[model samples]
Every structure is written in C-alpha cells, then in structure tokens.
Target chain A: MNSNGTTLRRIVLAGFVLLVTTGVRADGDASPIYGVRMPEGYRNWQLIAPAQEAAPLNELRAVLGNDIAMKAYRAGTLPFPDGSVLAKLAWKHVQSPEFEPASIPGAATTVQFMVKDSKKYAATGGWGFARFIDGKPADEAQHQTCLACHQARVKDHDLVFTRYAP
Target chain B: MNSNGTTLRRIVLAGFVLLVTTGVRADGDASPIYGVRMPEGYRNWQLIAPAQEAAPLNELRAVLGNDIAMKAYRAGTLPFPDGSVLAKLAWKHVQSPEFEPASIPGAATTVQFMVKDSKKYAATGGWGFARFIDGKPADEAQHQTCLACHQARVKDHDLVFTRYAP
Candidate 1:
C-alpha cells in the first residue's frame, strides 16, 4: 500500500478501538454485577413503589425507573426489556416531632440501581446492579450481596421486589 | 439555696441551654438564609410537582412535601400553614435512548427546601430557604438569591412556584 493510504488505514483502526472501549465503559464496568452507573434522571422516573424497613436497617425507600423500565412495569412485561433501568433511594428513618408518632427520613444511606441489558448482564439474570453512597460507588463485596438477595427472594418478579405503585 | 439545690439548678440551666442550641441548629444555620436541612423522609413525602427547565441550568426537578404541606395543598389553602416543609430535588437532564425524545435524569444538582414557621421566619415572609449540593451547604451569596427570586416571582403564592400536581 502507498505510505499515505497505510497511514490513513492505521488512523481508522485506532479510532475504531477507542470507540469500542468508550462504548463498553459507558454500558458498565467489567464486573458481571455492579456494572450499571446511576441512571440519569431516575428520580423523575415514575415511582414503582415506596417501602419502609425495620430493625437493623430502618430505612425509607423509594423505587424509580427510566422510560423502558416504566413501560415494562406498566405492561407487566417479565424479564424486563433492554434499556430498562431502576433506581432505589434509601434513607435512615427518623420520627417526625411535629407529627407525633409519624416516621420521617433521616440522612440518606444509599442509592442503588439496576440496569437491564440481556446480552451484557446475561449471567446475573440479564440485569446489572450497583449501589452508591453519597454519589460514590460501593465496593465489589457489597455488590455481590444484591444479586444473592434478589435471586433468593424475588426471582419470579424478574428478581425485583417493588411492584408498580399504579 | 442549699448546696445540693444549687447544683441541681445549675445542671437544669445547662441542659436548657444545650437544648435550645440544638433546636436552632436543626431548624437552620446561623444565617437568615440556608438554614433548612433536607427534611427527613422527603423522598417518601407526597410529590407535589415535577418540572423541567431548559438551557443554562437544564434540570429535572421534583417537589415533595411533608404531611402539613400535603394537607394544605389538597385542601387548597392559600397561605400554607406553619409546619409545612417542601423539598425540591433537581438533577441534570439527559435523554433516554431507549425511549427517544423522552428526557431522563443525569447526576443530581441540588436539594433545596422551604420551611414555613410563621413565628420563626416572620422576617422572611414566613418561610426559610436552604440549598445543598451533594450534601454540602451552598454559600451565603447563593442562598440570599433564593428568597429574592421567590419574593419577586411567587410572593403571592407564599414564595412557592410548584402547584400541587393533583
């Protein structure tokens, strides 16, 4: 090949590699689980459910979803379609002094997310899970527990606990 | 007073001082503005409205309120009674690729709050304002702008912008 043609071909190949790497990273990290980033604008997504937990983890929880997740939730589609994303925000539960006996939120504890991509997260039932505390990613050990708990309890509901509040 | 009686009185006075300081800090900082904390369980509070802003500060915002605020909103009370607390959570806006043309949330931008206490905040039109970004308080100059904008644009609505969605 001519010198200029060779140089052009090499540049194109390098560009292709960079593009692929960027795409992979954007989808998620290398781990089977904990690959999902906190999905964009998840708080504005439709509310799937709200929950309160007692005992060791006294938390007030809210589950929200992106468009694909909301559509699947409303339609009752199982094995949720690709591009579906769910975010669960949790806070420590406190008592409302102004409204005696009523519970209120304390400090925020965690923000967890699940992204459904059948091909990408096929091992973990086609879903990638992640948890963040104050916007920082949780460790791998913590991430492992997410799949185990969901698989054991809510495997039937596509390994999800919250139902569509609507 | 006897020695034991004097000691008891001193202890009581110290306790009272401690309690008062704690209460003041809880309601807000020393500044007239930026005193409100993210009210406990605000995410679980009733959602009053959801909004989107364009350009410069493109954001998706959700407004949530405590029981007193929710009741007042439902009852259509104009002035919003004392004990009402409203939280506005905003995030960077992004597009949902799965559902093209629909916007989704990116990273969170701020969590702002308005607290009504007629006796306490009578100086600022019965409301105290605060803004936090990533859990840290915004500066005094930024906080001052909150009341100015609200007083100018929404003075009639008691300095609130979002109407109850229901």
Candidate 2:
C-alpha cells in the first residue's frame, strides 16, 4: 500500500475493499495476476507495525511478517531474504464507543501481501505484490502500481514501508 | 487490560513489561501459576482487536484468537467454547517518522492470554490467564489481577476487554 496514497488510489482501494467482502469476484476479467497468490495461513503471522491510513481509505492497518520476514527484522538485516513475506491487513477505522480515545476496526477492507523472490520479482525490487478481498485478487492495474509507490517512497527500506514495530 | 486503567495500574504494568524484556525471571517467587501456561504458536492467530494503553504503559496492543476463539467471535457466541483461547500482544507505542499521524510498534512489552475452560476455572469465571515475556510467565500476583480487572470492566462480554473488530 502507498504510504502517501493519492486520492485516486484511495478511491480505487476503497472500491476494491467494499466489493471484496460481498464475494463479488472479477473472474471474467482475464488479466495477468502477476503470479502473486495469497499466502496460506497469512492471518496467523505476527504483527510488524500498526498504521492508520489518512481519509479516503480511512483504514486501520496492521502489517504482519512471516517467520522469515520476522527473523530478518529481528536481525536488522537489510534486503530481506527470498522466503520472507509481509502481510498487510486493513479494516475500516472506527471510533471505539466502548473505549474512550481509541479506534477499533469495523469492516475488513483488504488483505495485501508482498512476497520476496530475488530471482522472480527482480524487476520490481525482488518483491511480488497482491491485493485481495475474500482471497479474490484485484485487477492487474492495481498490481502494476505496487512497486512504483513503494519504490518512490521507501525504497531505502528494501521497498517496504513498515518497520518492525516490536 | 483495562479500558479505563488507573495510573497506578499502568505504572505497575509498565514496570512488569519493561522488566520482562530484560529476561529478569522471578523464579525465586514461588506462587501458584494458576495452571495457565502460555499457549503455543500464538503468534499465528488471527486478530481480535487493536489497543493503545494510556500514559504510563504507552503501549500498542493487538489481541489475537485461536481457531476456536475465532469461530465463537464470528458466530457471536456468548461464553466462548472450552477450547477457545485469546492472545494479547503488546509493544511500546512509538511515532512513525516514515508516515505522518501514524503510531507504530517499538519494543515488545508483553504477551498475555485468556483461556476458556468452564469446568476447570469455574471458581473465577471460565478463564485461565497468564502474561509472559519471552514465554516466561509473569508472577502469580500479576496472574491474580487478570480476571479481576477484566471481570470488573467487561463482564458482559465474556470477561474480555476485546471485541471482534472485524
């Protein structure tokens, strides 16, 4: 996800997140998926950081890491290993009426991933990307922009925006 | 965790969280562990809610659910099943210079848990509790306070501070 996402980007992400929870698949849209499939059991990963997307998307986000990704984070290794993967789970940010001065997740928005494959995704900083709702991949147009935003902003952090919060 | 914690409580929790990371085991303090050991593979569980502790603790928290716990959450079942388990992972809350108005995880603080087993823990609700650092359990005195705070605050919600945000 873009750290400084444009209004157009947020709008597109908002639409994708909304449609995904409804189980509305774009199966007929035969475009290249960039070979980025949702990782199995991504939900079980440990958190890397917490984020709040500015308005438009207005999502509460948590970035999680696979074991390999976590190891690299703990070791402070630059250029994460090939097996490393990161998952970004997002939800509609809502005020917690039950808890004062706190925000809680409302509806789930998107579950995005960045998979490292030095040999495969070499053209895009060794990371393959995917954005999904209900495990249904977003259109290719969305995938195409992943690296551009990440590279433009946090290319120094191995093309990743999240730091190991813990 | 208390939704409206007192300053004293935050101070105590802060001390415990800070010390745990240093590997300062309280092995000399022989007190009943309440038969609540840290659950295995807890890092792989799905999220329940995100929390931010006030002032003294100044922590970012994410509560996660095991398979049984998640099933009950999604089905809106009251009094979670006997096998259900919840894990609360907390870290020092820090600002992200990389992204504006965003707070990220800093150093890890504590990993706490609530396990539901009505028959075994019928004396003080159906929950068993523990707080740990590097998988080492907190002192028994700390364990004793878990249910008291939770039951006092959120008894209606299965004695849990977290609600399924997604």
Best by lDDT: 2
Chain B TM per candidate, please? 0.81, 0.78
DockQ of each: 0.02, 0.26
Each model's TM-score, in the order given? Answer: 0.47, 0.66
lDDT of 2 by residue, B1-166 (tens): 3645777788889878855642223342222455666654677677777766656787778888888999899899998989888888888777776766666778898888788889988987998787887667777778777777777778899887788764
Fnat scores for every prediction: 0.00, 0.36
TM-score of 2: 0.66
Give the CA lDDT, 0 to 100, for residue A115 in model 1: 82
Q: What would the C-alpha RMSD of candidate 2 be, to one decimal place?
A: 14.8
Cα distance off (Å), candidate 1, residue A134: 40
| Alpha carbon lDDT at B29, candidate 2 | 28
The residue-level lDDT of candidate 2 at A144 comes to: 81
Can you tell me the DockQ of model 1?
A: 0.02
